[model samples]
Target: MRRFWYLPLWLTLLVTGCAGQAERGDSLYAQLGGEAGVDRIVAGLLWEIAEDSDTRALFVDTDIERFRNKLAEQLCAVADGPCVYSGDSMRETHRHLQVTSAQFNRLVSSLIRVMEQEQIPVGPQNALLQRLAVMHGDIVAD
Candidate 1:
C-alpha cells in the first residue's frame, strides 16, 4: 500500500486555485524547480516504475529513454516550463494499450513518489497532477 503523503495540502491548494501564485509569471514552472528539477522527477518516476513488479511489465517493450524525454517534455509544458511535448495525443498513444484504472492509479502513485522524493512542495506537485489528471479519460480505455 502506498502512503498519500501531503494529500490534504494537495487538496487545499487545488481547492484554493493556488491564489497569489498566478500573479508571478511562470512561478509554477519555477516553483517546480525548473528544468533540472522536472528532469529529476521524471527520471525518478521512470526508475520507480521500472523497479516495481506491477508496473515494470507495462514498459518492457517500450523505448524508455524516449518515453522519459517525452514525459519530461509533457510535464514541463504542463507546469508552464520552457519545454513542449511534440509527442502523439494521449488518446492516440494509449488507444491500443487498453489501460485500466488500476494501472493509471499506479502510475499516479509512482509520480507522487517521485515528487515526494524530489521534495517538490505539495502545491506545485498537486497543480501538475491536476493538469495531468485531465488526460485520464483519454489514456484509459473502456
Candidate 2:
C-alpha cells in the first residue's frame, strides 16, 4: 500500500471574508516562511514529485524551471503574499492531463511532506492547503 502522509488540519481556513483574507495574506506569508521559505517549500515539493514515480509521469513533458517558478508564484499568491500567479487557471492547465484522484492525492501527500521538511507549523500549513483546496475540482479530472 502507498504510504499516504495526509493532513490532520486540512480545510481549517484562516480567513472568513475577503477583507480578512487580504489582511491575513501578509501574516500567512510570513508564517509560511515568507518568500525564501515559500521558495524552499515549492522547490522541495517539485523535488518530491520528481523523485516519486507515481507522480513523475504527470510532469514528464513539463518544464521543471517554469513549473517551479509558477508554483512558487501560485503558492505565494494563495498565501496572500505579494507574488501574482501568471500561470493558466488550474482547470485549463489540467484539462488535458486526465489526472486521476489518486494522482491528485499523491501530489497533495508530496506537498504535505514538503511542508513538513520545511518545518512549517500546522496552522499555516492548514491555512495554505485550505486556500488551495478550492482549486481541487479544477485540478482533478472529475
Candidate 3:
C-alpha cells in the first residue's frame, strides 16, 4: 500500500520536473539570437550539401534556389522560430524518391556540420536533432 502511494508521488515529481525543464529549454533558443541565427545555419547547411558531390546528386533535377528556401523555412518552423513551413509533408515529398537510411543519415550529418559552423549551442542542437530523428521513419522508405 505504501509503495503504491509512493509511485504516484514520484510520478508527479517527474512530471513537474519535465515541465520546468521544457520552459528553460525554450529560453535557450532566444539566447541564441532567434530567427537570424536559424537562417544562417540553414543557409550554410544548404551550401555545404550542394557542394558535396554525393549529396548534390540527390538534388540533381531540383531547382536549387527553391530547395534552399524551403529548407530554411522548414528548419525555422521546426526550431519553434517565427517562420511557417510551406513545404510538402515528408512522406509525400519523399515517396517517389525511395530514400534509404544511409541517405537520411548523410543529410543529418550535413546539417550537423552547418550547426557546428554556426556555433549553435549544444542543447538547442541536440533538441533539434531529437525532433528530426522522429521523422526518420517517414523519410527513409527502405
Q: Which number leads on lDDT?
A: 2
RMSD of each: 9.0, 10.9, 6.0
lDDT of 3 by residue, 64-132 (tens): 788778877777777776779898898887787777787788888888888887887777888888877
Against the true structure, candidate 2 reaches a TM-score of: 0.81
Off by over 4 Å in 2: 1-26
Q: How many clashes does the backbone of model 1 have? A: 0
Stretches of candidate 1 above 4 Å error? 1-23
Error of 3 at 22 (Å): 7.3
**Which pairs in model 3 have colliding backbones?**
none
The CA lDDT of each predicted structure is 0.86, 0.87, 0.77
lDDT of 1 by residue, 1-142 (tens): 2588789879988867745455556567798889999889988998889788777767777888889889989988998888778999999888878888888999999999889989988988899989999999999886
Looking at model 1, the pairs that clash are none
TM-score of each: 0.81, 0.81, 0.75
Clashes of 2: 0
Better lDDT candidate (1, 2):
2
